[model samples]
Target: NAGVIQTPRHKVTGKGQEATLWCEPISGHSAVFWYRQTIVQGLEFLTYFRNQAPIDDSGMPKERFSAQMPNQSHSTLKIQSTQPQDSAVYLCASSLGAEVFFGKGTRLTVV
Candidate 1:
C-alpha cells in the first residue's frame, strides 16, 4: 500500500548468475504489471497479476524468467541463469485500467 518499492535501484549480475527484483504495489489496486525495457526490444510486457492471481504471463520467457505475487501488496521477479540480453530496466506498475503508476525500476546490467 506504500506504492511500489524497488530495492537496489541498480544491479549488475555476471552472466549465468541470478538476479532477483522485488516490487510492492499500491493498496486497493489489484492489478500489478511487470515490464522489461531495452534498447532493442523497447518495452515488453512480462506478466501481470490481478487480485493476487496470475492473469497473463504469456509474454514471459519460458526459460529463466519467472514472476509471482504471493500477497496483495508485493510481487517478485526472478531471473535464473541470466544472460547478457537480460540487461534492461525492470519496471513494476500498478493500475485499475484508468490510471497506472510505475516505479523507478531496477536497472539490471548483465556482464
Candidate 2:
C-alpha cells in the first residue's frame, strides 16, 4: 500500500497546453476518486471508479477533461488545451469501506 501514487507532483504548462495527471490507488481498494481543489471550490469531486470501472464524471468538464480507471491500481486525469482557470491541485483517493486515502496531488499551473 502506497496509497496512491501521483506523478509530476508539480507541473507548469503554458496556456493552451495539456496536462495529464496520474494516480495509482491502494491495492485491494475497490474505489478510486479524483478531485480538484482551489480557493473557491475547496474540493470538488471530478470523477470516480469502482472495481476499475468509471462510475460518475458529472463534475468534469465535458470538453477538455477526462478520467480513466484502466486497472485496479491506477487512474488518470487528462486536461486538454488547459487554461489558467484549469490550474489547481488534482487529488486522488482510494477507499475500501469507510476510510478513504488520498494522494499528494498534482499541482498544475498554466502560465
Candidate 3:
C-alpha cells in the first residue's frame, strides 16, 4: 500500500490559465476524495469517487472544477481559468470507511 501520492507539490498559474493536480490512492482502496484547504475555507470537499465511479461533486465549482479516476491507482483534478481566489491546497484522500488517508497536497498559487 503506497498510501497516497500527489505530484508537483506546488503550482503557479496566471490568472485565467489552467492547472492540473494529480493523486494516487492506496492499493486496494475503492474510495477516493478531493478537497481544497485554505485559511478562509478551512477544508472543502470537491468531489469523491467510489469503485472508480463519481459519487458526488457538490462542492466543486460548477464552472471550472473537474475530477476523474481513469484507473484504480490514480486520479486527477483540473481547474480551468484559474483565479487568485482559487489558490489553495488541493488534497486527495482515500479510504475504505471511518479511516481515510490524505496525500501531501499540491499547493496552488494563482497570480
Q: Write one digit per residue (lDDT tens) for candidate 2, span 24-52.
A: 98889999999999999899999989998
- Candidate 3 local Cα displacement, residue 3, angstroms: 1.6
lDDT by residue (1-111, candidate 3, tens digit) is 667999989999999998999999999889999999999989999999999999999999999989999999999999999999999999999998789999999999999
Backbone collisions counted per model: 0, 0, 0
What are the runs in model 2 whose C-alpha is more than 4 Å off? Answer: none
Q: Clash pairs of candidate 1? A: none
TM-score versus the correct structure, for each prediction = 0.94, 0.96, 0.97
Measured with C-alpha atoms, the lDDT of residue 60 in candidate 1 is 93
Lowest lDDT sum, 10 consecutive residues, model 3, at: 1-10
**Model 2 worst lDDT run, 10 consecutive residues:** 1-10
Off by over 4 Å in 1: none
